[model samples]
Target chain A: MVAKLKDQMTPAERASALARGEKVDRLPCNPNIANGAARIYGCKISEFNTNAKALAEAQIAVYRRFGSDSIRIFTDLFTCAEAMGAKAILPEDNTADLLEPAISDLSQIDRLRPVDPYKDGRLPVQVEAMKYLVDAIGTEAGCSVGVVGPFTNSFFLVQMEKALQLICKDPEAMHKLCRISLESCKAWAAVVMDMGLTPTISEPMSSCTVVSPRVFREFSLPYLKELVDFIKSRGRGVTMHVCGQTNKIWTDLADLGIAGMSIDNVASIRQCKESIGDQVKVLGNVDPGSVMYAGTPMDVRLATLECIRDGYDSPKGFVVMSGCSLPVETPVENIDMMMDTVREAGYPIDIEWVEAEIARCKQVLGK
Target chain B: MRTKEELLAELARCVVEMEDDSVADVAREYAEAGHDPKEGILNGLIIGMNQAADLYDQEEYYIPELLICSAAMYNGLDVLKPLLPQEKQENEQKIVIGVVQGDTHDIGKNLVKIMLEAAGFTMIDLGRDVPVERFVDAVRAENPQVVALSTLMSTSMQNMGRVVQLLEEAGLRQQVKIIIGGGPVSTAFARKIGADGYSVNATDAVHLVRELLGA
Candidate 1:
């Protein structure tokens, strides 16, 4: 069955098409579909965070309605933490975050053990949701599963404040926590990849800009490399999403085993492409909150086009997207405007369209 | 009279000890020893605070440590301010700082506040989740030279922009440098929002503030 599907359009082919390195019918619209899906499917943000069924349904609806190539289900930050017996809080208006980890003391690490994703707490729900999604649309569309990075999980387990202290005070414990997070991540990645979907890890806290490069090297990169290799070894593609000015670390990330990077807007695309785009696929830099939330449709359009224009033109693996998660309240038309900008442009952005886009933005913002 | 080095050593000891009584005692000793208050702030308290900032950057200390040290510096400065000449007492540049509306993240803001104060800048912190009107009202009342706005979440970054625009509309923007910084704030976003300056990290924040103040 997989062979037959590959004969028609391979993963490389699909990746190539999205990257604009190869010619395709249209640009791939793959938003990091998260809580916005819940809002789209009429599930309250509260329910979306807490209820598995609501979360799954909303993700499906978002993929179907938006024609997105991929749908991201784990919108909340507390995925692996909750699985590890951390207390998580699901605020109605805010993102789901881990309240406290079960491992408050170094001695607790021995007591706490990794769980099978199918039998674990929220991990099971996420996997089950992915399985349902696979049965429904995974074969037809790209199904992306989100995983937390080692440092973030360490922060969750010991509580952020204590976790930060531990990183400086007890480097050994931090590494121990990272090891646990890495193992759990591999187990979790296996569950998602079994559904024949790609796996993407959101490394929100592991940015060199967030922590020192030395700390990242000590605490994050090793686990990241292990997890990326583990996921890829299972025959699934991996993309690591890091939120911050990580231009300095693009080469460091490329040196790791991930297939692609989803970087923030603060990091220069020209520099990232120059440094690591040849080796790995690069995904995003669109300012989601700035352009998608507040800017006019034209702002979205111009910025989207600029992302593609300044792109490495790596046809097979690049995916143009927002630098970070889509804000829950982001205007739908603004997203539409981004897609429209890309769709209107061919492989390369024509100069006339660039001028027209600039005009449109100026007109919208009245600048 | 003690040499400048002795006065500075005493001030450093006061910050490390972080007791109000010790800080006040050393502050009076420094003043009675005939050192300039502004010079004591620059050479003594500022050095200790920068050390704390360095400690934070190097992961040697955390927020609580910085806060307590800042409190110590403040305590010593309180005692020193009264004895100093009027001009020297007013020498520290005053700035207004706050987290923009709908954002409750104050840890980063307070870090900036402490670092600024440690750098010898007088800060009027409006605390977290500050409305735009309050920023403007504070600007009108306090007439600070720089208004530093902070927001952790990407969603509330718009409020920083709104505050800037509101200030601009009220014809107060030109009067103050609108600086925005936090986890989510980027230099490009700050430029888009028409902010005067943006810094990615805390140390850069101090430099940005000094540059804005032309100090």
Candidate 2:
């Protein structure tokens, strides 16, 4: 049936239709969830962050309850960083943060070789959780796992401030730390793939729009290139989530052998489709905060439809997702709206809904 | 025999000095020169810091550069504070800033605080991960016109709502405008929690302060 639908559509039509973009049966809803789903299962964020089983169960339960298309398994950016030696601080009042350094000093890099994910800090726990998830629902249900990018891991290793300074003062030390971070991530990526899960890495700092594109290249790029290669060599799809305004390095990132790039609202999705849309999958640009948090479920549905509409034809890929992690306070119904939009709209859709959103834009343009 | 170049140089010098104590000099030099305090702020310090903010956005500048420049701007504002006419000085708004509980992400919050201070608001920084009670107590104690909350983690968003609710429960909501922004914070979330404003970056946060204060 999917092939038949693709036969009737344009290349963009085929891609969006497969993904259930607007004009298709309905849009695919695959928003990134951290520990937020834990609330749905009556689990604490602390439990959700530390215990892989609880985390997996809560994600599964939430996806099942909400009728979501995929269950994203990301327990904050500190998971892989922890395995590299950063201590995970799962606080009750906030997202899990790293408590210990992955490397206290550059000397520790030689001492801090990457361990097998199965034997490392919490990797086995995560793999076991994925295995449990696979056992319960299987791959037809769509399960995704997260790997922290080297730069973010390095951020935890020496703290964000110290890391940012080093980008300017000690580029070589930053590069070495990036390597360790990559080793840890590659280890997790290997394990997640073995468990039959799609691997996605979140590059929180690759956007010079956040840090510097130069720093991103000097401190982040080479190692990330290696991790991407590792994932591909394993025959798994590699999704890159570059948070913040990353238009500055969009082409650079797209050229890095990534299968998908998750973007925030800062960059125009259409522009992204035009630039790297053909090279890899493009998944996102939705202001998850606005539509998912402040707007009504219908608003989320409509805004998602708009994203799908704008993303109608891409090079090789498109996935409906929020520009960043879904806010913890995001109403579950809003998430459901995204899936519903995809399911309802099907594929090859556009901006009539955008007309309402564009009122602010119009006022800005004085049209 | 003051050269035009010398005067401009002095202007730059005083602008840096404005942040020295209370930014009184920032206000004073302009007031003495028969210039608008708002114009003085725009052309002199805010403009410079804004450039710094741009450099930050472009990766052309880093935190140390941002922090020290903001510090210099804040000091210039200090030197200008007492020198400004009483009306313009009094017109300067008061802003209350804090990092919500359970978040030790101080760099972004501190940057916003510095930006706000540079924008000439009397800032009461409650520091990082402040409890709800403290936010309430600080508000009651300082009676700031606006309350700005920062939280970098998705987990602390609930705390932000609690702080907003606490202010509302205390019947202080009407008197204080609430603004929130940080990594992991969305404008939608801010509106969902009944905050008056949200901005994506520190520059926007400073601009939002202007809008919230009706300046």
Candidate 3:
């Protein structure tokens, strides 16, 4: 068989053009990188979670090996919470968990001090690491730092039960804690955006699965818009990510002041592209757990192709990425297959080939 | 100051509104009024908790919301437990629930526990990071009709299949149904691991349990 053509532009150019709503040479591919990078560095997730130098090194290593459009500096979701007095429990191979809340009660919302990224919590480790990532690849790649959203960070600070209780019992206190968490988010973002990298806000708890659209409208959207505006004002770009069941909140999230948005696997990418593709940049969402971790490299290829077809058929501003965190045990060969499919089958996707492939998928999927 | 029915409605309302602080007070009032604590609990608190669970299934309520509502439910239960009559059943449908070994993320498991309890299932919650042997031991001890397993990590999902294998070897597979859930779990995964049922969210786990147990 004769070779098919690939998109001509570089990944960085494709990413930049797509973010600006300009024509892209092809879809930019950035598999969701986080603790997944630890596997590449041959270190425990605890090392990546605790040590700044290792994190920066591992992040860069994955960027080089995987050939993603963006180099992300997201280690875990609890750094800001750790900064604000919530303790983090770092496991040997898994991501960190909240050991204890800084303030057990809502009464302490007022007493909560601001997180200084350099001085407070684990945010400084990330800041120093991201500086290294940007220094290494400032011009060659897209650099973005990750942080949890306001609602989630607040959950870490007050614990989960109180976080939900205050929402109904005292909206004022919940909003207050969310705002404080946003400040921590902004403080962390301020340090990294200063290095000219975009900030990818992974706000999983703000999704419709965790909150009603009514609650999301009340709490997450305003704070996110403010986060976007603040980042843009600093002369940097912004990317938003919410992990699961984001379909309910996509229209509103797409309308935010962001350069790109990452939707998880549960949401329909085709609908997202059709509804808001003209408005903003969309990234993501293959099932990071099953397809990337459990399935074979061929599975990754098929998923990548399906995602590309879904995105390409809709509009121009879509970047193929994982739906959520790529598991720490995700196969390197699977990553390669995903990138290969993007390069081989994505650009100028053959209509007959995709149709044939879809039929085969339905047959293989036993539908 | 209020009648029993009004206090019951108020108890349910506090849970629907996520008023963890006030549900306990309403329970106390209902008890102080010479109202049947069983009636107050059944009519007031569980009703509200069931409403919250429904809302959770509908995605209108989340982990946090359900967490507080359950707290309120327990508060009311604490006031009513001593007065309630001993319950009787011919064959009690028991359930053993826990996060499978190597998984520390228990919020999903906790939600499942609350929802199952609200649905009136007797649950032996082994809690998070429970070893595989502990599950077999729990089954042997409790003789549960079902074992509901949970995990948020794909890495720990391997343990679910192992538990099923251990059960088969121990000859308990014929006696008990096994169910699985968590963020990374799907219907396909549950099938792969020999789990009898799978639910994506906490609320549906109750429905799954009810269906599996013929409840």
Candidate 4:
């Protein structure tokens, strides 16, 4: 068994020091565990998301087990949109599937109204979960709630293909939908901020892999900038996660004045560190599917070390995280290996040792 | 007063330019000019769709552009398809496709379907949130040349493999090629699940089907 390395500071202290550009005991690690928390807490996926107590208890359980730096409150990206009259099909053991969009046609744009976090759909459940988490572990570890970005939320209000079609065929209607979606986002963020938590934007649909950088510039960027500015105006820093290829818009994303960016595994972390590391804190991007969910412990250790090697010396800071939400079926041992690897290779990472270990892990894993 | 060549070129240009609202008028004009409807579809709309695919491959166009271009192609198809002699539509190669069970995200599946249709395969779309039994039933009913499964979530990825298993158990696996694609699926996962192939994108999906069916 690998001996555990002792941390010199609590997660909160480490996060504070890192924000202030000071040294800390270890590299902060957050594997973007969301649904997986329910598995750890021994509850059905449906209950874990809908019941605030279950959600909070599950997150606390995962944090206790993995000792990741942050308690991330995320159910799915569609919660806010679901609140605004979109129909979703909930499964007993999977995230809710959107059944019907709120505005199936642009002609129905008038039907969308800003959500009330406390009274609408599942936003209240999420807010209640945040309250429980903040009261329980807010002082010991950092906490953030996943808020869907305006552009992605807009698509949730309409069918995705129709929404993309509107980008070329009907820009005005697209803007109208996005304008209303932004209002829902702000309402949710305001609720989160009132509880003193950062609202991390998860914009899975806005990735360049789905839409071109030009589309992002015209449709997503302006709205994202407004959301980020609004968060900043509240005197809170914001982080963002875009789920697939983002290298095309690294500079544009950096220009948003975001404090941190969670890159997907599909994008090059090394390039991200080089291009925008000086501007924003770089977090991410181990392969959540191949490594964390499908591979063995050794594979997890190797990927974790590789991420630390690539991102450890960023000018702003770095947080080791999964490329996206950890699949609910990810083996617990793989997560243990990730945390162990991070703990073993704590701050002032020994480049020589990390390189050697990476080599050894690769050989053992036959990669 | 235009030549057949001029009409075909105009049809293709309308699609490539994403003239979704007007491509059908060009198709109707081609039909009114006593041109071959099949020629109008093959040399006109499909050619333009292929050009759009090439642009998507080159990153000169993206999803929004592809979606609109496909709309144009479909609009043109609506005008030209019924004008075809009945027997012409019967022998096209067929493929069954869907987003696997427990996953509802279908833009990727829709793109692949569009590309395959543009490439001339008749797609038996099961749509999203398809149960595993439905896949086996479709193969029994359609006898398609290929079965393509998709899922954006890793949790539902196992259902793709289940479909393969049920097909084999029903003694139907030998008749069709199985292909899978999506955000979390990989060639390694495809091989593990005994699928015939995996594609990384919609364009590649069309090529994979062709290669699998030896088309």
Candidate 5:
């Protein structure tokens, strides 16, 4: 089902209109395509992530080829840790990793210096990429600078187990570490916002799968609310994402005052629509790991149709997106399948065509 | 003068409460008063960890609780290991575990290690971001009966498969079982990658290894 769009606005315009509660041509297709771009350009991910010029070129290559509704500048989850004085292992063809956290104990958390996004490891590379995108494609192109949310960044600075233990064992220290993370996020987001880039805060480990709602409310919620308020206070937009089963905290997330949300596949977009009632923009929830990276093109089409159908009738707006970051080796054919479906989906969905495609895809991607 | 059962129960309570510091105090008391340290662990410390594991199975305790309980359990282990018979220590079944290459998420792997050690399996933890070839080397060196592989990233999912193939090429596949688990791993992926078994939670990993060994 190839869609020849008659009314194709720039991705920036469509996203802006959708978030503003106005009519849109179709849902914006802006999955967080990070290292996947590195693969497309045939460059080592380690090199692509570190070099500003290479990062810009890879993003530009993806933008030109895919015509995805939005362009996201993502370095890695560990950039926040690396920026805060932790040593990171950046591999040749993989995402950067920091084995030892910045804080070995709670006492050290206070000593962590605030990161300057300009001079920090590869953060400037990210900001420059965002600048390059805005320059090359004009401001009409959708763009967001990705930042790690405070809750997950806490784990980045301290080991996940030790950090989580602090939640129940020593919540006072946990709260303080979260405050430190919040300060770091504000510092980083301010830099990107000053560059005219929207900051998208992603908390991959903040899902129900990792922390129960009680823990989330105590540790993650207030900090997130603060982050959103800070971004909004500056009169700019912010997007928030959590990587796995987040249905438990969906309402809290909707009320966090972000322009939009990106959810993982385990979260049903239909439920998300009901919970929020179109008060905020909803993006995402195709299983990036299983359906997009592992499954065939037909699986991608099926998953894309499922997300659209569930969220198409929402009150706020929805963008068709992968639930999370595309793996380093995500297949382009599957990506094209998602793009094609979004282009053809026609605003106020073409149910008849969609029904036909769903039926056809069912046959192709049968259980 | 507390009964033997009552003293052990007190020791068990220390672990269940996640009091790492006071657990050693209770162990020393149990030892000074003539209670067997090995039994202090088996019927005392291990029992407490077993209760924690049960709570974990019921979703009452999570990673944090388990880690604290493991800390308490290790506190008791440190006091009791010196008392265990040398023959008992030398003859225990061993298991090799690691987070596969390219994957650094080891909280799950660490949990499994804690549970397995509490269950009395000697573990050789290869640590996170482990090379694929090391699985074969560990299997060769440790002669362990099970090689457990874990990865949290989807990109590193293929490395689990590579470890399996490496075991096959090294002719060590049949000598020991391969078990895999993590966020992105599934039973289907395990089968596709030729792993012998897959368990989503760390608690179930002990059972999987037991079933593989017919224990």
Candidate 6:
């Protein structure tokens, strides 16, 4: 049997203490398990996403099984866009797919309206799930609802190809679309806060892999600042996850006054910690695809240990997590190994042992 | 009254500058000047696209710039392609590409298609959310030298492997080289799925295809 490290505090207490600039038992670990929760609870992705009880129960099962630091509620990135009238294909066993944008042209932007969390598309499904989770296990762990950032939601409204073209062809129209998307985000986030859950922002399209930093500043940054300020004004801390290479915008994103930032595995967590560790808490970046889904238990252990060694000492704080959301088919044992490694390493991580183990693991995993 | 050299330079500049509206005018000017339509495409618009690709490789231009440049290239192609002899229209190397089933994110796939087309390869674009059967069928129908599969979603990534298996079952796997790419895909994944290769970005994909074809 593998040895497991004991937790000295509950997940909620650990998370709270970490945010308050205090330390506790072990490193707070969250693998961004969202749709993957369905697998743990034995439900199809479609059933889990549409049914509030299934969503909440699956999340609870994940929390119970992994003792993860947070319960994340997110059906897909297109939830807000779908609510605003974009069409999507909901597969029986996979996440929803966007079929067509709400408006094909920016001229039709005026036809779109802000989404009402209670009344829009699947937004209500997400809200109801949050309600159930908070009611059931609110005090035991941190709960967050993943909301699409304005830039990505705007792309969903007009399709990414059109949105990118609009950036060079019609700047004003792009801004108008983003503004509408921003309001939708605020409206949905306002309701999440009302339920006492943090709203984590996801802006996959804003990553440097997709757009230039110049474009990000012109198109995504301003709207993100406004949304982050709105969330902070409500006295809630917010975190952001941008799903590709984001090293170019670390300084820009850090300037947004966000409480924490989730780094994608493609980017270096060590560089992120060195650059912005003082300004914001760093949560990330195990390779969700290579290490979590395709790797073995030992690979997860090595990757988790390597992440801790690199990020454990950030001045602001660090929460070990997957580089992005785990693929639904990720082996449960790999996730368990991640938690077990964090438990064994515990707080006041031994740099020497970690360093040696990292080398050995890298050699064993052929990194 | 511009000379042939002057006309070609303007054609290239129009594409590099993303002058989509003016590129057609420049190509028409080139065509009227009796400059070889093939020279206009190969030396003019294609050169500009390669320059833009260089900027992209250097990170000076990103997807938006690349998209607009490609649009300009296509506009220029619209004017010059019709003037070319039928033999000039055919390219020796043909490649079929698509985003695998259950994934609609095609920005990467489209970029690869543009770069491959600009590099003088004939491309049969299967578009986004293409089924595995379609890929196998396209392989049988087109008999292209290479097949490219892409997906942004991990859930749909398995379909790439399924496509490979289907092609093998259909006895068409040995007929073409298979390459895979996307956000979650890695070289290891390419190897695991028995693909011929994987490239991280669109620019490298051109070189990968060339190398795979031994061109």
lDDT of 2 by residue, A173-205 (tens): 888888877877877787788788888888876
- Work out the TM-score per prediction: 0.78, 0.79, 0.91, 0.95, 0.90, 0.96
True contacts kept of each: 0.11, 0.34, 0.42, 0.61, 0.42, 0.71
Give me candidate 4's TM-score against the actual structure. Answer: 0.95
- List DockQ for all candidates: 0.21, 0.27, 0.51, 0.66, 0.47, 0.77
Provide i-RMS per model in Å: 4.8, 3.4, 2.1, 1.2, 1.8, 0.9
lDDT of 4 by residue, A174-222 (tens): 9998899999999999999998788999888789888999888998999
Q: On residues A1-367, what C-alpha lDDT tens digit does candidate 3 reach at each position?
A: 1133444676677766655777655567877767878888888888876688888889889877867777788777788888889888888988887789989766778999878988887777777888787777767777777878888888888877667767766798888988988888888788777767777788888877777788888977888888878888887767788877877787787777576778888888888888777777778788887688777765676777778778766554677898888877778888877776677655455767866766675667665
1 against 6, candidate with superior lDDT: 6
Kindly report which residue stretches of model 3 are placed more than 4 angstroms away from their true locations once superposed: A1-9, A16-26, A364-367, B1-40, B58-60
Tell me the number of clashing residue pairs for each predicted model: 4, 47, 1, 0, 2, 0
- Residue B108 of model 3, lDDT score: 85
**Chain B, TM-score, each prediction?**
0.80, 0.74, 0.94, 0.97, 0.96, 0.97
Between candidates 2 and 6, which one is better according to TM-score? 6
Error of 6 at B67 (Å): 0.6
Candidate 5 TM-score versus the reference: 0.90
Alpha-carbon error at A112 in model 2, in Å?
3.3
Candidate 6 deviant stretches above 4 angstroms: A4-6, A19-23, B88-91
Instruction: Supply the DockQ value of model 5.
Output: 0.47
Off by over 4 Å in 2: A1-27, A48-52, A92-94, A103-111, A139-142, A348-367, B1-51, B57-93, B184-194, B211-215
Our model 3 lands, by Cα RMSD against the true structure, at 3.0
List model 1 lDDT by residue over A37-126, tens digit each.
767888677775446777778888876566555677777667777778888767776576555676777888876666578876677667
Give model 1's TM-score versus the native structure. 0.78
- lDDT, candidate 5, equals 0.82
Winning candidate number (lDDT):
6
List the candidates ranked by DockQ, beginning with the highest.
6, 4, 3, 5, 2, 1
RMSD of 1: 6.4
Two-chain DockQ for model 2 = 0.27
